[model samples]
Target: CGIFRLVVPCGAGKTISALRYALQTAERYEKRRIFYIAPYNSILEQNADEIARYIGDDSAVLRHHSNIVFKQDDGEKETKYKLLTENWLQSPVIATSAVQFLDTLFASKTSAVRRMQALGNAIIIVDEIQALPIKVLKLFNAAMNFLSSFCNTSILLCSATQPLLDELNDYRICPPRDIIQDVDRYNEAFRRVEIVDCIRGNGFSSDEAADFIFGLAQKVKSMLAIVNTKATARRIAERILKLSCGDSEYKVFHLSTNMCPAHRSTVIREMRRYLSDEKSSKKIICVSTTLIEAGVDLSFEHVVRSLTGLDSIVQSAGRCNRNRETICGTLSLIYINDEKIGKLDHIKEAQEITREILYHIHMNADRYPGGALSKAAMDEFYSKYYRSLKREMAFPLKDDPEHTIIDLLTNSPVGSERKQTAGGILLKQAFREAGEAFEVIDNTGKHSVIVEYNDDARKHIHILLSSHFIYEQKKQLRYLQQYTVQLPTYTIEKIGAGIVQENEIGVMILSNEFYDKVYGIDDELKI
Candidate 1:
């Protein structure tokens, strides 16, 4: 099996080139499956559709993410029912997430580990591989090493800015060829963007950001402002609406993960149509979260980005000057100080590292003007960043010691020469005790139901319901629509209780009581 690493910038045809490589691999090796793993479901959905269209074969494609599988089905619910009635691995081209693939390597259940067989003799293209959990870096690399060495599989590390996966101690798997040999050559060929570091005092405030956007909207045909969070995006969009007098003249759009995939797709399609139309002024202004950082191909003459991770900043830059048609447009990286920004664990660390790098670049711009923000600079940033976070990165899943426990449980018998047997048993017992805290819901409902609640629970329940691509919830059912609900555990102790019931429709429960009581419903009802 062959390996490669592609470090092309965004909108540089990475996806298509990777797809072509995968096809070539399949044809050359006579492989049956091609696994395309992405960081997000939105990207998986987009790529799967495009592949299906190009291949001209619906049967060859399989989309296997939690969000996309259970999304609100279009009018073709019946057709979808017939299509997804079987296991996902049977398809020739499968799209999934890195978590799903890695889960199989450390799976405790038979169902979760079943996909391991399909991974053999396949072309695995990991898009945006840097988005992988830092803690699982060791485990992820080990799995890739095993697959590439023993299972007759080829791995493609694909990203705009590839992370330092190979730098890890005892890292396994190496690319056969450098996909983008000279990044500077590719950058020069595909460079259409100009970076503008806004002077600190001149940067836009919340109110001023809106005013500046409104001014741009009046001048340009379309503009996009990529902010750091959903709250800020919505607030900025609202401010722009208030400041602009002729609200009816121009269209203002707000995009974030707060909206479901179906909703976002509708918005994206509408925007594309408006931009493509010749007569329509459109004057579109879209404020979005980091969700639009990749896989979305939208071009704008002006892009204003809130300070964030360097990779994300580059991704935002990619959205601007996309076609290289714009001679000299500006991408403003504004300095925004919000305490809430630090709440994001990963982004917080990234921001700190980026700030330090910017400090150095500010002192010596002639040597590292924009180069400080390039992929090579990011490499240095993460190297130091990981060293500082080595302990955390080494054991991210400290809560789950089952893999170690299982190895000990199977390898060493009781009353044997293995001195660690007692320690392993203790760890296993602790894990088993902690596992009881999580309740597994049975989602075998007869009529599809929607769990509605406040935004937080709603998001979780939505992910669970859509986990296996089951999207037939009733929109007219209000009671079922608003409260967060989970599948009731099938254990005998949890059956036929007030908060937990076993009906034909599946295990139904009230999430509030379940969380508050801590005990199973049967015990709570007895109390």
Candidate 2:
């Protein structure tokens, strides 16, 4: 029935605090269900396990997500967990990925709809609210507004960099009262990194940048380099390996959506040991896409980020000086003159607005010695950003303002288009059309593919494809969670021969020949 926001910055204990609220709400409200939604599974896995332990009962906890379970069960009997996922019932505390939550909000299927009504009166916690894509902001806002107004849900928007959703004219709610009372003090308490502009010389290409990082690797214990694309990440990692003199003792890690969840998990576990060992002199360099910017939590002495949104810059900064173990970590914004990132309009636009903010701050650099990420600088940065992007906060489609998925889902009037009845009830909800228009991950369409990541995943895949025993198949699915990755839909069509194979279940499979041992899904996959 209300909205509350926790504007806690990253690495500032938001997860633990959110869990406390979930527990308190369950106890205070008497078995009211609690829905905790995060933007990525990397966070869900870590937080879900922690929450299950703190709550003192595994039976009460629910982890519902796309990776864990598929929508179609194919005549197999449902497990208790799968049944809960289907009905969204009887669990006091549930954690899910943002994709699952958003997709469910607009899904037309009977199973997906069954969960929506039960969400009324639950405590809905949306973490990393800023990460919501601009194209879908209007739809997301409408969904949030409906949940609070009609469903009577206490919606909590939690993020270190809260986007202030209700600020839009028609979004919803009175200015949400901050759940984290002292915003200024909270940010001050967790100040861990300093932003430094790495604009020097002729600007560095991915190759030159990797060489620069390779040199730094010889001196530093651990570092992270974040780039815009998977291709760029792979190029940098390749450059690093080639530039090595074959004499250095170090490890270069590559991470992206190309790697299955299980592969990424293995890399993270191995890297964590190296990062935590202070006595060990091994240097570690991780080349990754923006996936590492948000949830994966390993701190590094230095972080080099390809120019992107200021919000993403803040996230990248979070990965630095994360543990508060040092004086301050360094966050450098790298300008790759040779690389041109124009395909993604959203990211490119954000980068343009960020550059403008940087220009204004660069003019007064002497007054504010802390660079563009300082409190005052960040305020100005976001001001220009939100102002420039105010219209885009609402979703739009060409020649059809009345037909955007947002208008259809909410039954909102759209300028002489759809009419309502005297009862103020929509005659047609158009659930199927809404679902067709909604694409949480589709900047471009992607196809989910299973991979032979390891022996465990291979065994699970085989069992899942052939097994008739319902219990064993259900268990195999939980095991296969880490072995799935989504590839661009076009890529799957092009590489359809020896590499891509369709299983009996009708899902795509990328053979081992196509999966890279190092960078994952060979950089040459596009061809």
Best by TM-score: 2
The candidate 2 region of ten consecutive residues with least summed lDDT is 413-422
Model 1: residues >4 Å from true position, as ranges? 67-89, 170-176, 199-205, 362-373, 398-527
lDDT string for model 2 (1-527, tens) is 57788777679888778878766865776636899898888888778887888878977778887556433464353456667787777778889888888777875667667788768888888888877777677677777777877877778888877775665656644457677776656676777888888767667978888987777666667789999988888889888877764445777889988888878888989899888887877678899889989866789988999888888998899899788657887888877776657567767777778787788777877654455555455566556666676656555543465456666556644422433443545445555666666667664476667788778667767777778766666566666767877777667766777454535445566787778867778545742
The alpha-carbon deviation from the true structure for residue 365 of candidate 1, after best TM-score superposition, in angstroms, is 5.1
Clashing residue pairs, backbone N/CA/C < 3 A, model 2: 1-152, 8-160, 9-160, 262-482
> TM-score for every candidate vs. truth?
0.74, 0.87
